[model samples]
Target: MKLLKTAAVFICLTATGCSSLNHEPSSSSPSTRSAASSEKSWWPFGGKKTAPETAAKIDEAATHAWLDAYEPRLREALKDSKFTLERRDNVLIVTAPVDSSFNPDRPGMLMPTTLGPFSRVAKLVEGDSKTGVLVLGHADTSGQAPVNRQLSQERAQAVAAIFRLSGLRRDRLLLKGVGSDMPRAANDSREGRALNRRVEIVLTPQHTLMALLAQYNTPAKAGPVLAVTQTK
Candidate 1:
């Protein structure tokens, strides 16, 4: 009887220990679980993901005002050269005749007189960090297509180089050669061909001004509204 009682006591103690082990609380706290959940949500391949940057908005009114102030100065500076300045919206377009700007003897070399006007333009634009410049070269349809394209590109590059030398930032200048593809006039007559052969310099507002405008001019989102008709 004593041996049986001892055995029964030992079995009861073993059962109680197993029950206590099963009822023990989890080791992780609420804060620890939250940290783990946050990591899982943000991490991809063990690296945290970041949101992309939003682009800046352009202020049309400010841009146009800037161009308006810029046009007369550019026109006065290039009065002596065979260049014409026209303002369109937020952009100032300066058109230079290739015959007058470049030398006939040297393919892509600019004329000495042309240098003064271009330098003056560079001086005017270089001071304004809000503006960007584009130099486009155009050729008449007189030469072979490939040759004309290459000539136009070289001329555009030469103009950009002059701007860079005259204190303009290289990053702000864009150069392109359109060849005979973008003729201002018909290529059938001599006068028309002369008009076709030209270099166009375009200046407009850059990122900083545009971004400032964007912050203030964001359009408000419209919400749905129910309309009720009145019966008389």
Candidate 2:
């Protein structure tokens, strides 16, 4: 799946036009696009009121710019793993497999060790304050509700740990572990299952977009700042 996400990233789309690999043409829709992105996204989750300051980043150029900013730190954080970088329709996408070399245990919940990094688009679903929740894409209702919820929560926790490791405050990023009750893809096929196995990260408006926006604009003047930069 990580390999697929990398292949389908923005740049790959531009070069090869492999559109079917992702959710749908709608996944590239306007509403889900980042509010601060330069181009207009077809983000299915976006509102019509997306103004100049709150525009969707639908174009590949804008998404690339966004990823350009985080690549340095992200690369370093996962430097040892094979990383696939993709830019498609203005979305900076990355796919990296979990390195058993780094940590051998399977997450309490099974999902992508490295979720494709369109996570940049995860903005405050509501007014900021750092608190947010996302459903596990893979969870389904066929299983027991309690087990599903736990599974969901585990996926959330794993992603939350990742966010914390990435410097997101524990208080700021929240997760609710909604299980298979909600699914982004069909329950059939290996491809569908792979697509569904994901963790979504979201931010709230209680916090301002300034920090992310700032990072997006700067594009990290060098390589791998996450590991190399002194953590104060």
Per-residue lDDT tens digits of candidate 2, residues 1-232? 6556643343333222222222224443322322222332111122331223533223345334544654454455445444444432222233332232112354342233333343332221222232332222224554665665545444445444434333443334333434453354576765555444444442222232222222222224222211211100
Off by over 4 Å in 2: 1-67, 71-142, 162-167, 181-184, 200-232
Number of the predicted model whose TM-score against the real structure is largest: 1
Cα lDDT computed for each candidate against the true fold: 0.58, 0.35
TM-score attained by model 2:
0.36
Q: What does the lDDT read for residue 86 in candidate 2?
A: 40
lDDT of 2 at 11: 31
Residue 27 in model 1: lDDT:
43
What lDDT score goes with residue 210 in model 1? 23
